[model samples]
Target: MTATLHTAPVTIPDTTDQRVVRRRLGPGHRIRFSFWFGPALALAIWSIGSATGLIKPAILSAPWDVVVAFQDQWVNHDLLGNIVASLQRSLVGLTLGVVTGAVLAVISGLSRFGESLIDGPIQIKRSVPTLAIIPLFIAWFGIGEEMKVITIALISLVPIYIHTHNGLRGIDGKYAELAETIGINHGEFIRHVVLPGALPGFLLGMRFAVTSSLLGLVVVEHYNAVAGIGYMITLAEQYGQTDVIVVGLVIYGIFGYCADSAVRFTGRRVLAWRQTLEG
Candidate 1:
């Protein structure tokens, strides 16, 4: 018998036909374009109107004039200094608000008695307008940086506290029972399960808190602050410098967007596993 050489058929995977998954644009990406595009289109229209003398240059400064004013402030380093001051106040307020709110949330979540003690006052405070409390804050802390930071923190606290409390309370009883069945201790359960379960709500609250804090910064700095964007806007208004005021407003908007983006980015990074599991 003649031995015939047998060759095994080789199977090739269709790499060429493999589908590529395109990542959908996230809210942040959409927002990035929306924020810049809307304002840019508006500025273009305004520029056209100003050039045609349809709008008064004095009342609505031309885009070029605004650009010139921005450059002037940049060259003088006044804008940078104001930005730093505003950022400092916002960061300080955010730190205080997040820590206090999270601590209160944990306490209130774990104990009905603690919730009863603090929930009523927090609810009452929430009903009151944050801007309305600025005078009291100033009176209590004096017209200083502390007053501004405190006001921002106070404004930021309510949303975070509410969301965190709700998140913790929303934890399913089944999860706890399952943990118990698995012989998980309270500490391990909280660290591995409770925190992960509550993360989405907490992160949502953080986003809200950060944005609120930035907005509150404007109101807080409006009073007796000599170095913030709000103070710069006030001064600009006094001199009928509409361009400068507009610039300050735009800067604040940018800052708010940046802060919101940061919270969202952090949430995505920290909760990546949770998101994957959910999906």
Candidate 2:
């Protein structure tokens, strides 16, 4: 006898619902892989190399030696003084470069006549390398702090101008049309739309400016009378003190990293309206 068996239809739970809930949680559950992994791995490799004598202390000092050198320099030498000097130069140059670039970008982006007047000269100057202009700068400003600061400012200017101008130009015409429809004044339009739209580009340019300022400072410091990180590096090289050199380089790296990080944090805060694809 065939019994009529009532079979219930199997209902499968949609996994997509689970996935959506997890995704909504952001990166809260995931480990900060990059934050820890890279440094940990690098330290492991470095420790192993140093311990095994795979890395020679003469040519490239061990990590411990570098630490000792840093301590020595901090205690004995004017390390903080050098750092302050470098910071002052970098900040001044970066500020000047950013201001100048922002002004030029606004002028050129807002008007065709301004573009005609400013763009050609800027483009020409941008083509010329910052280091190449060092000789010219030396001739004009001499080997003093003025030439060094100006060199950094000039070096930083090109990237800031290029990125900011591009950003300003890239804004949609529709937005401008909408602003006009609403009877928005030029100042209001710029304040509400243009500046916000171009902020990402300006931030990008600032990153370049930060790096360029440091590069300019390093190069300029090497040339003449100076009391900065670059001068410490120069002294280390003269004495063949690889550990001291490493210390100087490490300081520069830390400074650059901190500066870049600040800019990035600022971007994230300022651009909270935008959804970026980056994890």
Candidate 3:
């Protein structure tokens, strides 16, 4: 009777057994969203302001106007040609700058005598703005693509050199000691260790250099250039076609973003181990 009168055991769920799903944003996810969202929001606000006439449409065309202009340029294939020309110059300049910088950085990193020979001259040259040398470039190379490419290369060289040199010198001392203990020759060590370690910085510098190169293209093409995005902008300016100028500006912005993203993607792939370690 007592057992029969006993109450059935309560079916209570354990608090610990309940799932506690975290809704918090992760650092990586947040960073990724912020990177894209910030620009997008700003652009949206700018477009809305222009469209509503709150901002001067003549000075800053509405987003729709730019889009239409872009479509017209695209349909005419004018944008495509300009983009290709600009890309060709940028790639050539970037290649030359990176190669020259890498050579100089390796020399400086590996030999004290080489460092002493080049470092001072590089520092002195770096102090003088490369933009100031555009005239010299024009005089020596003439007002052609060569002058543009050389100017861009010269402008790009300093950042890459500085970063590469710093990266090489910044290598962990332990690794240097280990390489020496393992009978690794300086050349072999540089190939296997120094270059890989310095690559991230080198790539970062290249990104900056490329950006500068794009900006310089405007100046470079400001002269006798007949085709290129910069040339298109110059034409637009001459005609006072704000819409076309805005389209050109948008193209440059997009191109710069793509270039920087390419560099960043390459760096991420090349420095996967470094990223993992940092994470």
Q: Give the number of the best model, judged by lDDT.
A: 2
Estimate TM-scores for all models: 0.81, 0.87, 0.85
Candidate number that wins on TM-score, 1 or 2:
2
lDDT tens readout by residue for model 3, 1-279? 455666889998765444221212333322443447766988989978986889898678888888898898889757888889988987888788878987898899777999999889989988998889888888899999899998888878888899889888888999889998999997898789988998877987888887887877767878788889889988889889899998888878878887887787788777867634222
Q: Which regions of candidate 3 fall more than 4 Å away from where they truly are?
A: 1-26, 29-35, 276-279
Top candidate, metric TM-score: 2
Per-residue CA lDDT of candidate 1, range 74-162, in tens?
Answer: 89748999999999999999889988998898888878999999888989999998889888787788999888888889888988899
Per-residue lDDT tens digits for candidate 2, residues 1-279, read 898989999999889887556656765344544545766788789878999999878767889989999999999999999899888988898888889988998899778999999889999998888899899889999998899888888888888999999999999999999998999999999888998899999999989988888888878889884698999999989999999998888888778878987897788788877756432
Candidate 1 accuracy as lDDT: 0.83
User: Order of all candidates by TM-score, from best down to worst?
Assistant: 2, 3, 1
Q: Rate residue 157 of model 2 by lDDT.
A: 87
Task: State the weakest 10-residue window (summed lDDT) of model 1.
Answer: 19-28
Question: What number of backbone clashes does candidate 3 have, counting pairs of residues 3 or more apart or in separate chains?
Answer: 0
Quote model 1's TM-score: 0.81
Please list all clashing residue pairs in model 3, or write none if there are none: none
Q: Cα deviation in Å at residue 80, candidate 1?
A: 1.4
